[model samples]
Target: MLRRITLISASIALGCLATIGPVLTSLYFANRDVENRDRADIQEFADKAMLRAELVTYQAFAALSDLEQQPGAACSPANLEQAARVIYNYRYVQDAGAYAEGKYLCSPLLGDVHDKDLTLPPPDYRTNDGFLIWFRQKSPLSDVRKDLQIGRNGHYVSMDPEAYVDLIDPARRPIAAIQTTTGTVFAVSAGADPNEMFNAWKHAGDVKSDEWNYAVARSSTRHIAVVVKSPRSSVVGDRPKLLAAWLSVGVIAGALLGWLAYRRVTRQLSFASTLEWAISRRKLDVVFQPIVRLADNECAGVEALVRWTLHEQAISPEVFVRVAEESHLIQPLTDLVLDKTIAQLGRLLAANPAFYVSINVSSEDLRTFRFLNLLTKSLQGTGIAPRQMRIEATERSFMNADATRGVIAAFRAAGHPIYIDDFGTGYSSLSYLQTFEIDVLKIDKSFVDTIAQDTASSVVAPHIIGMAHELGLEIVAEGVESEFQAQWLRTKGVQYAQGWYYAKAMSAGDLARWLGKNRAARTPDSIGGGIATGSIET
Candidate 1:
């Protein structure tokens, strides 16, 4: 009898363990699926919010563009008032003002412009693009409390907070903000006061406090974020009590699964942190993509593209660059790229005196003092002179207007050529050329590809080339992937070209060999000595 009882007890114990194993596994996977779905939902919300914000910004810019298009109206008081009136009649703007040279020139409310420095928050309150937006501010032009204040360069625009209020859905009750690299530009709340929530998020340090925080969604561009006050429980669906019972029955297995999940999350978060370490370890590498001159089919110069590999996996520029910029790792990473590229190309540059190299830089890098210092210091002992390196900035670089112009002036003062990379893509590309001291405008690839397509599509490239030439800025057509496209760009008066049509990116050694092979086919000897490098300013 005793042996039979012990056998039954052993069987029961084994049966229970068998039941727990599958139950725990199911619960773990179900929980993971729920978490992923929650994350996806939040991301979708962020995407929509960002799209809305962009649309609003674009609308506001359109009003300014229309005003700017009227000749001599940008600074004219009546014209400025007309511009402001146009904006004010719309639902978004409360008022508008003309800004130039870091001062307010005119406003609809205050006609006859005086050089009043805008009443602005400090630099910390502004975006990396130099846009300072606020929910409310004392207007230098008027005494009324304005709902939204946006100031960049000498320009300022005031909008009713109600403009942002209508953007979000009624169900989400989200607090949204327009942000840039430096900080938040404009923030608004639909239900609760956004300032309170923003402060809480900024000051909260503990997980307990964070638990009470809103579900946050961010834009891909990292320029906007919408914070929902809804509880996490809404998105993270509540599991039935049976899930807990099953998990409790196999606590040890559940704990092990949780540990695995934790490890996965921590590993993912380490990617951004590891960049600094990677740079210090010399893990970053550089490749040179030759920019050929369409005029002679000779390689004009090369654009340095940064490449990185980690843990035996190749990382694309798109992946790591956004991460670096978001984490404030851009400065260090940029420095690394510049250092490595210059180091690799120093001998080659020394060998070909006329060859110049263009390096891409972020607006943040251009704005920072460290960027200038780094360039000046890095080239001190190198064979390459400042003239041999051109600073390439995107259309976004000019959004800051005065600051960007000042920075470009500084680069020019240091004897470096400044080129606007990916021209014609920006909403204000032409405006930037007219307003800033631009040395070169690289026609965006999209436009170049269309240049030789059909009559309708082909007109854009030629038109841009003509406009750029008219502005006295040299043109470099990008993405000339075919001979037809190249020939058309040349006919349209494009000075330089870059794309696979000439040569894909290559190693420094490979570039040297190509340079030697094609030296005879470059531009006229006068244009950077037929090397298609940088244009020597007269």
Candidate 2:
């Protein structure tokens, strides 16, 4: 009766967990989609603003061309003033002026003006096709024109600040301000100082504030970029609210289901208790999956994989290992696996002392010095050199960089080579290679699987290999289950490989026997096809 109740309760709990996983996964992807859409919206706004700025700049240039076409217009103050008046009338023009040889020759505001002290700095950009220069500074005519000071010469428009502000009319409120590449700030709206938003984008290209997402884009034609931003709340909109609703519903349903399961529970059967029981009973064991050197088909080393069998059912490492981590039983579990692995491979290490064995380490294992001390003592007793034991870590182990770096440094100081497991399947940045002392990177099987398909989409695997090579790190390709994948990686200069194409996890006795038989050069297909199932347990 108790067994029947336990089974029924476990089934109901598993069903609740299954529902929760999909709900959470859906929420995650929905949030990602929202972010991608927001990026597109911001990019489009920047492009449109760029086009508007470019149009205004070109219009000024066209006016300059008209003045230059007029015979002696630049030399004659009357003609120049007349021309300036015509251009100023275009729009947003407060004053117009013509200057040459560092002195104003003409202006509609000041007729026949010549101020020897008047100075205009150089342009940020130049054009040889015409006498044109672009620059920005405080208005020399601030006394006369309260709002006009910034000018663009050669059809120079004496524009008020409103001139720049007006270009962004019917704007997507994302336009916080407009500024010349030459450093003149023009506010587009009256709210929070747009200069602050503009400066953020100018410095970083993209930035986010509590209320807004700021971005900067330069016109292909003009020297300045439009400072575009969107309300942070608008970008996320109601998606987060919807996600919250779904999550709330899921939590309520889970609670109800859990309650029902608990009422039916005959005896408490936690995974933590089961694992501890199994550990004490010595039901856990280690299996070795050979890491073959692709160049010579020689077994250079073996990765130690932990296996657990409880209640006549073989539990997957993914399941039990995660349970161990959550229960804080990982350190003891890791010690057990390592202790057993060394005992089993003691003969192989004695015969070929150079052979290395790789074992996986978690972030929790690295946060403390206990594992480090355990490793040192274990190897010291077994007569295994530090170089003969490779430490493997999934990229998630480095999420807290400061803590991870100390762990990595400790391993390096002890002389154990480090390998990054499942490289392309994590949040690992290219920065990790530079920041951490990594020796080998294992390309995930997902990338290797792509190469077997006859499609252009598979170029990523080769690129990953190329990137790893450029960083001066050795490469290991996982899941080379086909001759095609194997040959491709080999040609791409991948030094090592691990997959069923070489061998599955086996007992020490079975591996020693299989190694004796498979020393010759063998194609991936031949090796994959002729695997002796009776010799090695999957």
Candidate 3:
């Protein structure tokens, strides 16, 4: 009775421990989502503020231009009328006037004030394009004081500083400012000093203070920066609700975890047994996807992909392979693939000396010489050279540098070329590549899918290609679905590619017939037919 109680207590404790992981994971992702949304909102606000500032500045300059082209004396009636017209047309402009010799000569408000000696103060700032800016200037002839002034070529315009950020609703408005790239504050909303906001922006492009979240946007062409900040309460306001919800989730998850653990154990056991039986019965199959030369569309080689079926349902290789790895059955699974590959295409490979078949292997296979032994044993009487059976290991396989290096060296020494599969997806580094003497780098399909699209991953392919070229490693782009992608890869010096644009994975007979048809036709568009399903010898 005591031992049973102890075992139950331990199981409950373990269940709680496992439950913490999912609960914390859920909370972490929720927090991240909120933070991301906050960031996007502030960035958008800053951008809109910058654009508004730009439009205000452009209108000010345009008003000055119109006032300058009044077609008469600087303080004439026509000039006053033009100033009035500009002030009426431009919503941001508070006053328009004519200036000369650093003095306001006249305005529609203070008509013909040439003799009043309204001397303008020196400009607070000057833009690179010869426009003078005054941050705060007292009105010479009106009660309105401290309006922003911009002057160029004997014409000037005064604008309300608040107009730069007046587009947003007052209730939801954030503290914002328009400043120069050098942090000169010109216009700002209420609730904070512009200098403090600029200082925060200078310290970090985006920052979280005790009470606020701050962000910045900049225009290189206009040389202006917009700084905006919202209250931190807006982002963390739902913490109480989140805590309540996630606590409930944690309790439910704790209860479900035990059931899941039980199911997982049973499932793994059943899967292991089923896989062992399937391997013994030779029930697994191999399909070949042709890797063609991008320069001429000629069939260069094929990558052997393993497939499995259970109860008339196709099982993904990723699923079964992972179970095999966990069950310590990867070696037998690999042996089956190699045996079947040789059985199906052994004669074709032996006949076509230039042809090769790339086989995927796990990192465990590279930890020792057992895989090499298996390869040699499998090809002993097949009349296929060791080079014809190329070895492809994922980037993850190189994590054990010392072990993988020796095994890779052994594979290379045995006349088989070593390929780093899914080059950019995992454990990728220039130093890692330099450490391993690899022959080929296969670009993963994810990166290839981004080709010709405006996305972050689109540039990754070119960088990968360039890295491969600098290292003198051959490149093979996977998932090449469009001719545009093919042409793009061709221009980047990628030698090989494979995807639906050419042909999908097919059986041994289909690959043979596909190769034979391409050989006969010998044209770039010969493989345009969708998937190969017929048979003919090469």
Candidate 4:
């Protein structure tokens, strides 16, 4: 029942990870796209600001053209005032003035024309390409520039940094630099990664300012690019609501799926687990499968194989052992099998000292250090020499070389021999054979069962045998079922063979009787009713 719950929990956990994986992956990519868009949006906004600056720069040109168009139009103060008012009335024109070499004769749109410091020569300014640069930056936002100061208007104005802005109409952020055809200069907002943007903009930079992204380009002034940057925090500010809604839906769906999976699987686990215990308590019985030396047809040992005593209810070691391993019951069951086999071995000890007994201990049982001590203690004083005991450890046990060597050393010192079971199926087995000191290498059943038919197995067998011989190791080829395969193994100088070809695993009494036959069955195919009638009763 508990095993059922554990399996259900595992399935549910896997389902949750599967469902959440994609959602988190999508969220990561979505945020990256939003950041790219934010950069584009800023650049677009800057482009528009550059456009506004162009209008200011070109107005000066128009003023010069107009003066030439209307001869002596600036002769009278009143007329000049009227012209200044007309020219400066254009939208986005903050204040306009005309200064000519140390005199501001008149100003339009301002009540006071003769203002302070008009006598100062052009306020220490310069003109380049028919445009003027100011000694100091002029800022409309400051109160000092509230009343216009008169000057000669020697083609000089305040630095453009104060006036630079990429507006959503009226609002502005100061920028790095903007240059005019008439050589007027305006400061540009230093948006993030501005150097990259400026290169793209000045060389016909593109505008990508969406509401979520910002990129502004100005083709008019040789492509001065402006990017209004929204910090990542703000750019992704609105995403939380959308992501939250999606996340909620995903989590709810995942939970529902998990619940269903857990419920259905847990119920199945309960059923399977119940069956297991039921079989374990009343049905589990040991059957002896004789491990034989094919060369002389002599019994070397008998491996204790398990069976469900309930006939017509075939249970698979494939499924049974798997669940045992997963649920951590393999260790307990291994102990049970080992102890029972040893007790059975004790009964046969007097009959034959040469006959060894082998039991399969799971990989997990070996890792549990306590298992070793417990096993050793149980076998103590049984008059069972460690040499008389042989343990078949599956490949998984040897996967951890350090641990396997440590345990094997302990077992060997205690007079027990350890064989790596299910060889050829795991990684680095040949390498391990070279590195670790082991007594036996049991070939995997897959290769053992197909020795004659599989070319790979046929070729690999010789190489394996040679390697084992080089290592002074004994080789046990399991799952042999045919006379031809057995004879082939004998010819290959295989030391041991175990499979249905000799005898199916049978109960202790049956095994005792069978061994009492005292005669070797040479041909497996000749056995009557697919069974061996030969029985040895000692």
Candidate 5:
């Protein structure tokens, strides 16, 4: 159960990691792409605004220069007519005239305005090229309140201040300004304060506020700076659509990767690995099936069987035992069985010297002396005699007689009786059985099940019994599930048997209670099916 839970947790953690990786990658690149596009748009707007400011300044200077070359007195008729032509030719110039002693002398729309009170205020700024500029000065001629004035060479041009920022679309509500590099504002749009925008651009070439994204551009050839800004919402439009598309792809890929990871790890924890884990942790259980003396139908000994339960599911011994042998885990598995059998039944066997428990071992265990050494150590201080723990091996374990002969002899030398379990089911013949000095032969359950049945296999059991008798071997009939089979085996001189005819295999505590009940009722009539016919009294 714990192993199952751990496997599930590890798989989920890996799945979450796989999922988060692609989503984060998509988000990072998406945000970066959007920011880059917005920055590019803002930069283009700033560049266009700078070009407009430069063009307006260039046209003002050009008109002033043309008016200065009129070839007569500053306010003469020819010069005044020339001023009309200058105003007509220059698109941004509203007025062209002569100025001296800080007062307008004459021209064009207001001809000879010397008596018109056209005195100019102090110039707002002076350029490096000896030009004077007045930003948004009130016009004396009419209610036109904001005009830009520039003077050079005793001539001046007056222009509308709105021309510097007129390119902006009013519906978009963008903020724009044109100013000198020294922070003199020429013109500005309505939404944002000119001084604040200039200060933001001065400290940072471009800046982002909660509501806006700003960009700045400066003209190297003129004392001009342009600042432009757009709303943050406009720059991030359509971003939700992009996020949805990328997120869908990420979820699909993450789910695929996560599923593959889960399968790969689950496959790694197969039955072989699980069985190995159980043996190492000592989680396997040992149960004892009582072997009865056929003559008196009394319990004589037992056979130790190993069982396993995984995740509330019982794993069959036949399946897991084969898996262990094939995967080379049989030796450790046999060691665990031996250790548990001794630990659970050691005291019981010590008290009853006539009782012995048969333990099964694999072919690999008999191929070396390691198992013999382990057996010696397991019984050293347990007060359990070697004869009380009989060693049982299947016929397949005797395949290599030369390799196993020494180990078998060592076990017998240590006072352990050896029994060959599931006999007549493998390659051992009567002549082959003569090769090892084995004590007992356990007839296979298949032959025992065939007793009294009208089948050809029923005759095979008699031949196996006759063969064991000729070889001077004790016979223990296996899987005798009925009184008829038990009576037949006892009539054929089988001395011992183990099957569900008496009781099923059980735990140590249950077996103890069973033995107590059987001992208290020793009469022949107390046995199951009232003792088989032709049975002898013990």
Candidate 6:
């Protein structure tokens, strides 16, 4: 009877372990999936918002084009006024105005006028004194009448919380300001707040939130308008909610299965803990992908991509990074990558002095002064010229305004060339371009993926290269996967290119021979300097 009681108790304990193990594991993986999905959803929303805003702008562009036709029934003050009203009255327009000479064509109070008043600085960045874009009367100084301007295309600026509230406080009145690109401007308080205005503009897919942060922008007219909306509650529960919900259900179904294997799972969990502990010992390394110039088919440099492996099993960088970040291991990993890449570059310089390395940085790394200081000290110790080492700063680099600027300044003072990586992937690409002292712009692969297609990329790539050149910056066309893609980029005056066309992420041992072989092939009529070893990594 005592032996029977012992067996029964042991069975219950085993059953409990069996029930919980799969449930917990399921919950963990499900949570990861959900978090990844949320990120994907956010990215999709940003992309859609951009496309929709551009479409709205094009409506204004059509108006501008019609007005320019002039005198042949294509242009009229009434039609111009109609287009102006369509844009001004539209929620997405934020503000729209027509400019024939200099003046307040759309100001509800200022009516219409052409005048120059340079004595006071423009109001609200549109006119002087940060008040009314126009004066009560004209002076010779304000010659901004003829300077018709439109907001930059694809600008995603948000105004008042039009989509959030259904009503507004009578105390917090809404106002609309107007301005011309040439500096003419005016303003007027709205008859109804944006909450009232938003009611009429409702569409098929509007969502709501309590608090949202916004980036403001303007149209051709200085009138305030809504362009894009971001949901910034930044939910922490999102990381695990889906997993938890699913695991709760999965556990009920797996009771028998769990009972059968309860002992094995406890053992595995203990093993996982030990394995994780071993991973924490700071034994990580980095590998790099050579970024080759498309024009001559020779290596321009290499981009450092990170890797992690232990006990013959390699962990996913994505998962490792997420967990590592949670536990404050990112700094150590970042340092390891930087040191290894720098060391590799130093060795490569032994045979080839011109080769360089582009290292990726995380938003966390940018926030810490210690990491930046360590970087500076490391580079200085290596004796590599600052220009030879390019720091590939992504949109993530500037998450904190003050710290990011401080970090950039430190590196810049040290003579390091800062390259903006994945330039078009973020919503703030143009804004970043205007604000940062960027020396090179690496076009994101998604945009470059369609270069061979007879689509927007064929036209857009050249325009980007031209624009970068105008800004005195070099363009690096990433993801050049085909000979046609390579040929198209070269024709468009893009000098540097990098992608699978050359090599994959590799060790310094194989890269040496690969670089030497490709370097030699670029000389004198060697298949028009084509990378004959297509898809070859030594």
Per-residue lDDT tens digits for candidate 1, residues 1-538, read 9999999998998898899988888788876676557556555444445445544564455444445444554666557755665565444666777665545566777665565555445433566565665556666756775556666645566666555535535355555564534345356655656565455335421124433334554554335555544434432345464356566748758777887997786565467646655754567888888887666566667899988888888898999898888766676677777887877777767666667899898988665334675688678876677888899988887788766777788898998899988876776556667777778888888877676566565677777777888888888888778888777767778788888878888777777667666764544563445432222111
lDDT of 2 by residue, 1-538 (tens): 9999999999999998899988888777877677667667666556555544544554454445445444555547655655664465344445556676555565665556564456556544454554444333445656543343333343354444444434333434545434454465554544436568667656754554556666676654455566766665342478676566567878778777887887555122346556755664457988888887788676778899999987889989898898888866676688788888778876566456657889998877766444666687677766678888888999888878886788788998998899999987888688877889889999998889899577674876888889988999898888889888788888889999989998899888778777767753565654543323232222
Model 5 stretches astray by more than 4 angstroms: 1-269, 524-538
Lowest-sum lDDT 10-residue window in model 6: 151-160
lDDT of 5 by residue, 64-164 (tens): 76676568888989999888978886779998888888788986888788887788888888878888888877776778577889888788899987787
Model 3, 217-273: lDDT tens digits are 776447677777776534347767546656787766865797799789757766766
Q: Cα lDDT of all candidates, in order?
A: 0.66, 0.68, 0.80, 0.58, 0.79, 0.54
lDDT of each residue in 1-538, candidate 6, tens digit only: 9999999999998998899988888887776675456445444333333323333344444333333323322124553454454345344433333333223333222233335322322323432322222222232224432222342111111122222222223233233222224322222233533343233223211343443322222332323333223334333455476456567767656765776687686555434433333333435666778887666677767788777786778877776776656644455567677777777556454334466788877777665444555666676655566676778877766656776777776777777788888876665456657776778888888778877568765566666788898888988888878888788888878878888876778876667767667767666664353332222222
Which candidate number would show the highest lDDT if scored against the true structure? 3
User: Lowest summed-lDDT stretch of 10 residues in model 3?
Assistant: 529-538
Tell me the spans in candidate 6 whose CA falls farther than 4 Å from its real position.
Answer: 1-282, 310-313, 454-460, 524-538
Which residue pairs overlap in candidate 1's backbone?
99-154, 128-182, 300-532
What lDDT score goes with residue 36 in model 3?
74
lDDT per residue, candidate 4, 337-432, as tens digits?
A: 766676665656434556677878777556534455656767677765667678788776777777567777777777778888878777746766
Q: Cα deviation in Å at residue 188, candidate 3?
A: 86
Evaluated at residue 53, the lDDT of candidate 2 is: 57
List candidate 4 segments past 4 Å from native.
1-260, 275-283, 309-312, 452-454, 518-538
Backbone clashes in model 4: 39
